[model samples]
Target chain A: MKVSFFPGCSLEGTAREYGESIEAVCKSLDIELQELSDWSCCGASSAHSTNEFLSVALPARNLSIAERKGQDLVTPCAACFSRFKAAEKALTCESKVDVGIPFQGKINILHMLEFLCREEFSEDIEKKIKRPLKNLKAVSYYGCLLVRPPRVTDTEHWEDPQALDILISRLGGESVFWPYKTECCGGSLVLTRVDIIHRLNGRLLDMAREAEADCIVTACPLCQANLDTRQEEIGDKEGVSYDIPIFYFTELMGLAFGNKGVRKWLGRHLVDPRPLLESKGLI
Target chain B: MELIGDKNFRDVVVDAVGEEIFTCYQCYKCSAGCPVSFAMDMLPHQVIRSVLFNQKERVLSSRTIWVCAACETCTTRCPNEIEIAKVMDVLRQIQQESGKQAKEPKVPIFHKAFLDSIKKTGRVHELTMIRNYTQKSGELREKLKTGEWKNDVRLGMKMFLRGKLKVMPPKCGGVKEVKKIFEQAKEHKKA
Candidate 1:
């Protein structure tokens, strides 16, 4: 299946692994990713917090660009997906404002997890799993944006989303039942409010460790960055040791698919994921 | 405690967020679900109540607005369907537009630096953003003055060595168009 992919700003920089893993997994699944041409930043938490118009306008521009291509839009970053979906809702419901170009919501926006969870792709994914992730206990971390404000995201089971869990199960990994699956990872606040992230992500890491999962899998770059990078600091501040490796769901998928490029993607994580994969004999 | 009874404060908040603040029935669900509520000077539900009471100063100056992560947990959990996160965003905007200083200055400073980065290159350059943010953030400036900024600089260098942070700015093909969007939004804000 072909979809217009919106690799938001993070994908180009700090979260480059996410972009690479998505490409690797898509290639393995024979899913065609047509990157949205000339897509700009989605204005994320910054634009929306400061100005409403710019928040809607920025994502609307990219949405309009994708709409012109006549393909459903997919974004790997949960935050970017939320922004695109929010912009679509705002532009469609509100009074038409001239945003340089006209935007009519002609396409659907799907998070990468949502795209992969589609029924048709299930059989294809199962067929592609060369190395079953048996005995690898994984906890799916949905973070905030993927399934919140149900009206905007239309996420099925917002509080206890099972998309990631089901995907993990299909990949032959055991999905651990955890309470903080959809918890806030203190997202963009990491840039300004490290204390908040430390407190919030500390709880998340503790919960994941309590769950005894081998790794925490995430679909958001911001969440991955926070949970992976701040684990050491949070551990030190809270007087606990946490060494759980955070993985982009796509990286795990690439690994399950036995794609060689998965190593390259996994290498970029702040916390190395190999020991855990090695411990499980999945590598 | 300073009491502010601006009658139009409620209307301004409602109009800006496009959500009816009065519809909130004090369910406390928003506050209960807020991850950062423990750190907020005013709880999420109380912020709404302040708006209802026309306590503009209390609502605008509260540290809650600045600390809100916009995680949408409160918005999602609100039984009344109030967009509490957006309300917080509008409060922050109101706070800034009125030229009142943020109770937590780092949040606004970081946001401005982020938007400035976007405005320049259509994408956030980690290095540029941190530089701009450290320059604008008084807290960071103080840290820099005391040579305590080395820790953050070390982290940046680590990220750089790890290839997580790109040294060069990334430009989108539609930077001109992005600038136009910002310009149009500015005009709308003025209108």
Candidate 2:
């Protein structure tokens, strides 16, 4: 199926691996991604805080563009998905009049996790896995926004959003339950303000480590950026120890596809997923 | 700088503030990062404590309630997962409805204006939001002096040309569900 795909800013920049992995996996799934023509920024964390209108309009413009094309907008970035969904929610709320913002047309925003969890795709995914991820213990981290406000994301469930865990389990990897799975990864504060990040990141890593998982899998780009890139720094300052690699859900799926050169996509990972992928006997 | 009541309203305060009040260890981490805390008569932690202490009048009327940007810094810091920002939202709703007088903070007004802009336009139209906010806040002259008009006009024109800013609002689906959510929020305030 072809749908308008929004890779978000991070996916274009630091998280290109995520984009590549998504493309790789989609191709394997026989799904076609039609890029939205001339899409703009999703207003991210900055726009939402600096100017509400800019935030909503930035994403709405992209959505409206996608809506005009008669396709749902699918995004890989959790923040992008959440922000886009938020704008759609704000526009749809009748109280937009009360707040002085009026209702606009809505766009269907889908996160990659939701897309991969489709029943039809599941059977194909189960059948296509050439290398089962047997004995690979993994932790699934949601890191907020994916299933939040429940209404916005429209995922399976709000409090217990486990599609990621379910997907990991389907790949023959055992998904471990960790407490900090849905907790905040400190969002944009990773740069501008970071006094709290060391603690937050440390705690999350500690939880996954405690769960004795081989690696942590996440769907959000920012979360991956923070967890993967900053793990060493957090380990340094907090005096904690962790060398576990962070895997994008797509990266894992790409591995399950068991195609050649798939390891290169995982190779681009900051945390060196080779050791973990090797443990699953894919390497 | 002021303690409004003598009684230890800790139970009432904790109940009102919810469970996250005592979770704070007074790290000042939230205040350090807060954008509007400089203008707050009470720090973010103190406001949480005031609510925890059942000092409703003082907590609701404090300048801190008005100054919060809803940045969620305190909530982010609280080791106990207390939603200090959400609590401030509840307090702001109370302050607005009680007709109690408190100094209006710039950030909250800006946020309201921002939300108002979205509410009206279905998406945010920057020029309209700033204009509406300036007029409502009576900051038009200062806004003009700050050269906000020139920059806004330039950017607004650019966005308009790009078709990012819609000239009209979009029709809403599930209007009743949205309304019900708002109605429940209102009832929450009344209760």
Best by lDDT: 1
| lDDT, candidate 2, B62-127, per-residue tens | 877654544444555455777676577566655555555556544445556655544443333445
**Docking category of candidate 1:** medium
By DockQ, the best candidate is 1
User: Best-fitting candidate, measured by TM-score?
Assistant: 1
* CA lDDT for candidate 2: 0.66
Interface RMSD of 2: 11.0
Tens digits of lDDT, candidate 2, A34-127: 9776555564554454433454555666667787888877898888788788778766766541233333554567998888898989888998
* Reference-based lDDT, each prediction: 0.85, 0.66
Candidate 2 TM-score, C-alpha based: 0.64
- DockQ score of candidate 1? 0.75
Off by over 4 Å in 1: A94-100, B1-7, B145-147
- iRMSD (1 decimal) for each model: 1.2, 11.0
